[model samples]
Target: MAVTGGRAPNQTDSDGRSELGKALRACRGAFIGVGIMSFMINLLYLNGSLFMLEVYDRVLPSRSVPTLVGLVVLAGGLYVAQGLLELIRSRILVRVGTSLDEALGGRIFESVIRLPLIAGGGGDGLQPLRDLDSVRSFLSGMGPSALFDLPWLPLYLAICFAFHTLLGLAALIGAVILIVITVLTEVLARNPLHEAMGLTVRRNALAAASRRNAEVVVAMGMTGHHTRHWSAVNDDYLAQSRRSSDLIGGLGTAAKVARMMLQSAMLGIGAYLVIHQEATGGIIIAGSILSARALAPVDLAIAHWKSFTAARQSWQRLNKLLMILPRQREVIQLQAPSRQVLVETISLVPPGSQRVVVAEMTFALEAGHGLGIVGPSGSGKSSLARALVGVWQPVRGKVRLDGAALDQWQPDSLGRHIGYLPQDVELFAGSIGQNICRFDPEADSQDIIAAAREAGVHELIVAMANGYDTQIGEGGHILSAGQAQRIALARALYGQPFLIVLDEPNSNLDAEGDEALTRAIRSARERGAVVVVIAHRPVAIEGVDLLLVMKDGRAQTFGPKETILGQILRPPPGPIKIAADGGVAKP
Candidate 1:
């Protein structure tokens, strides 16, 4: 009922018991400290009560009223202190929980960062996992309650046993019974619950797919009907949820029965011991009061085992995720023995297609010289640009930077040296200046403003009331697409790479914005950067550099623009012509 119906991937296992173990140890110390301090307060109250009684019964036989007044003060003071210690214990444990979350959640992010390639989902998995409430749910649902409870349980049992070994033994037996009930409930319930979660992922995926094609859904009037199709997924999610609930209900009832037995036994046995010679009325009172303190943690542990299990599963999944090797043939090692870059034969693969969208493609742009790539839509301009930026591996050719294969470049140093702008731009929520600098802490304000001015966004920034400090909403939604793109360009230029690859840098820009981009590219070139722009329009680069026209993944013409315009008019694959008016009617 998962796939053919509705379900998604449900990976499992944990990093280890070590994380849980460490959390438990810290909680045990905290809870123990609370318990110890509370025990002292309780003991002192008990001792003081007995002392008051001795004074009333013997030393102050005629002043029993004064003795009673002294006992009330002692009891009230210690009671308040005990409550305070409990609060302190909880506060201490919350801090530990927060710190432990750093370990648990931090490791998940570390795994994500180390990966060179992400499969299938593009790493959106971090969104749900990184959320603070989700982390809280994960932490509360799994970590502290289990660790803190399990150890405190035995301490509870020992305390109960002190009142009377028989009563203590009875409570211990009940605890064991509750634990068995909980684990057994889990064994029977886990599989179906996992099934429900799988269905939830499918529902989310279907909803995502539906939203992606909203125009199609609306044009076809398929929204309402397709929405029903989507509801089928939700229906399955609910059904699975019911199955999970029923199984858990069965386990919960069993555990409840065991808990009731323990509660009833603690009362019955304490009462029996008090009536017999084994325990006193005060011992019975203490037993009733302390039973909750001891049993609370144990029950908590059982309740959250699924969460602990899931956190463990998340840890293992992330670790395996990080270990994935990139399928790209070029490794980008940056360590190969090579000096100046002079390419021989170069080839590149296009996105989502085999057939080497670029074939036998070769070019050499010297250190100070610049190269600009211009082509029609499917002519592999972006593919060539990606190869330069080391984003993709050439299927059958080589890309060398400074005479070494591009794969040998160390990623950090390579990125620091090579700036790239992919067609799709992404920005985080931050101030305009921060977005321009891309959160480079070391970037001087003057440098950021300078880059912004060069990218033609300085005037735009100044127009806003907050100027550079204006908040750009998430993904820079506060700005127009062209504005966002220019800011992204500014970020790339600010990096000052030796090579800059711009793919459709003007795709979303207006005519004026396009002019700004053209100026930025020329400026980058003037600054001694080897600029390779995958252009859709005429070259605004000042110099007459060479031009390459591609047809069916092969360069059909390679020469200077002044030398090749006629061939471009009647280019191989025939001339890309327009009919009627001028707007690219057809090829």
Candidate 2:
């Protein structure tokens, strides 16, 4: 069986538009408007050179003040029009970028959250978000405007050619040189820029890791060691960035210098033709302006080549990610499950892995009953918990709630009926009340307080300075581990879910916390909810009636809790006993 949110059935969609293309297509009108404006802006650009040519060729010879004044007014009007159109065009482009972001931001974030589950937590988690940022920045920046102006280069060159063949030839040569420089900039900067992008991801990951574990590092005197390692990665990233910058900067400078020299050459050629009586003095200045205008797009393109590359790369990565974890289609909502939780010979593999961690595990728990899963580390207890909560999918069988496969229900609807507290208790950066209600804006205050009471955290929360209004720091760092676990327990119990799976819920808890956890499980059971607790500690199972012991991804024992415990704790003739940590002990 395929994992949920894994590769789509059709990896390649030959007929469908890419997600990015679809987003852009939605804003096709804005892009078309930008194109029209670009055309008008380029057409108005001729006003300047033509005004100079007319003044030099006609007005200057006749010494006509009226003609000169008329030219100035006409040219100024066109310039103003051009500037207005350009401003509008730039604003439209920014809006287009914003629109695209609005359309795809939610989808991309959902993909980001699903990616780790599908890919087994490999690679950088924040990379997709970064890619989206790159794409948005490129679309909103001058890079796109420069690209739009490129088409006008040929028209400007044609005008230069119409002036005189020699002037045309000079302009043509300069354009060719700049185009070559642009190509070289792309070719040379590509690898270094790509390397730098990778280095940036690595550097960011390193810094995030260091910060996430700063307490451990500082307390253990490992800060210097991590710092040195960070320095090495930082140096590599900086070196690649510098190399790319230098290369692009050097080429951009070369393009600028070449365009200037070419403009001057066009003037020199125009002057030579004028002396030979083949062209007028006006042609010299006009040809230089036209040629410069023609090459300006190429220069701008060269300058923005780095951003273009980055945007292109980001687009490719986002495309691949979307393909791997395509948007989930709307599924029919299944009724809330309340009868029983069934694990029917289901085998599970970690996301992005072929190794089965929970193999052919079969067990069933009816409503109002509790099951405690006990096993040593790496025995797949946590994996089973994940599967039960639908965070993972089985490779061999199914997990059904009240006779309906979990996948048959829409994710959010199913989530509403289920509660899961993972081994690592994580809370968002919000007030405790918000976190308890799962950020549901319509959550009732009475229900929130009831959940806290059920989790035995209401008194603890009331004792806090801000009570439910207290803001938990990132990852709930503001609260101690025991406090976070109790709050998390409250979150799980918020809606009186049909199923509750707790993985090592008491690992960070003290005796009082353990009592609170036991009470919460009993309260859930009293409500006819299926409660499954994964724990290595014996005290955690004190309230559970049933037990499932796991070993090497397989169930080794399953029975009433007392029967299983008696079998486990019975003397085996030798001096060995069961240790508290689920290991063998010598007496």
Candidate 3:
């Protein structure tokens, strides 16, 4: 099954287990080929013991130089073939890993972008990529090889038994001991390893947060405090990691010692059989080699147990995240919006809070109209703006555009006709033109220039060292705050969006910038666009035709701009009286 941006229409699995299963299934042929090569490699492995047996039993007794030369050549050829097969198997595994990464990386990234900002509290948004890397590393590493070689253990043990029953019994007992050691490693390391993983995730998040706020850290002389805080988290991570390592290390050492003892014991048993004339010296050598081969995979597994467990945990977490945030399916293509926005009794509560941030907001704007939202600092102006543009879903009621729910339209399709400038403006690292054009590969130069002109930033952009091609550093740090805000405004105005929502767009603008913004709003309205502006200062909303007054999460008044402004600035008829219940009363 092909992985896409959204959940597949026919996908019925709730947990997304089937998606992972499908990725593995795509690589089934490669794995099967690797399995076959492993079989050949194991068969060739026995040639060493067989060569020793023949040399001691036949060549030595016969003293035929030609026979010895012939046996050496045959064994040499088999060894070369085994090495070639091993190389091919490794290559196949590497291809499988890359292919799996290619298939899921894009899909996971798309899902991460679509995730609601509130839902992604304290997450760096790159965790999914890291999880994908963990899975790929496991697939191409020594862990899977050890697992593949495990099934051949019985075959090696059967060969040991063929040599002599006592040798076979010794090998079996040694294998059992190693298996027990493996179990012990898991039981002892499980909790500590789990704790270490959680600590690592938190540490990464802290580091990312600190980096993003480096300016504040330096300005407030918080560098020392941040360092100490990070160090504490790092120390905890190290402690748990050390605990896990100590247990695994002790068990690994024990397994090594036991394997060595098993080899010695096999030699002793072989010597005893030879003395009784029950077996030849050749069988003694062959039995020791076969017994060691039988236990090799078990030892390797014990050595790499930590990585195996980490990969398993990462897989489970990734699956759960994908299940919870499945991709959206393709929707029927709809025409561009016609600048009609309807918000019906929409209320919004923050992701983890019970208090309503936006309460029962009901409004409508037709083509060629502008609405200004004025409110106090905590009166939910920003929240209402976010809901209008579909950033935050309303807990109750709906936001409709062109007679359809906002969410009913595919996100990309809906986004094309909706322009939004958030309270905090940010620009990615790229050329100025790219940022203004929304990073569209097929963006038209004429349209980009038009947008910059519309936002009154075209002259500022052209004055830069490279004009429209000037490269903005990370988060547009190369430009001033005002410059960045203007560029973001230009981005929102690009493509002549049918509906535009600006949340405190002029927060960083100077007097001249303010004039440019007013002109831009007027121009949009002239072009039949429905514009919504959230502002604190009255001057910023001078050109708006309608006004919405918000206070304490409720609409205080809504009407033409002149009527609401008059009411707000006008005094009450008589002295306001205080009621017994501490409420204001008009008599």
Estimate TM-scores for all models.
0.71, 0.95, 0.94
lDDT of 3 by residue, 1-587 (tens): 22224556214366544566678778999999989988998999999999999998899999999999999999999999999998888888888988988988887787567554546365556777788888899888888888889899999989888888999999999999999999999988888999998899889989999998999999999999999999999999999999899889999999999999999999999999999998998888888888888899999999999989988887777776666666677667677788579999999997656789888889889998899999889999998998888878898999998888887877777788989999999899999999999999999999999999999999999998899999998899999989999999999999999999999989999998899999999999999999999999777897789999999888999999999889989987888999999999768
lDDT string, candidate 1, 453-549, tens digits: 7787789789998998999987787888888888888877775667777776777778777778778767766776777666666744433265667
- Which residue pairs in candidate 3 collide? 6-327, 6-328, 7-327
lDDT of 3: 0.88
Candidate 2 global CA lDDT score: 0.90
By lDDT, the candidates rank as 2, 3, 1
Query: Any idea what lDDT model 1 has?
Result: 0.64
Lowest summed lDDT window (length 10), candidate 3: 1-10
Number of clashing residue pairs, candidate 3? 3
> What ranking of all candidate models by TM-score puts the best one first?
2, 3, 1
lDDT of the candidates, in the order given: 0.64, 0.90, 0.88
Clashes of each: 9, 0, 3
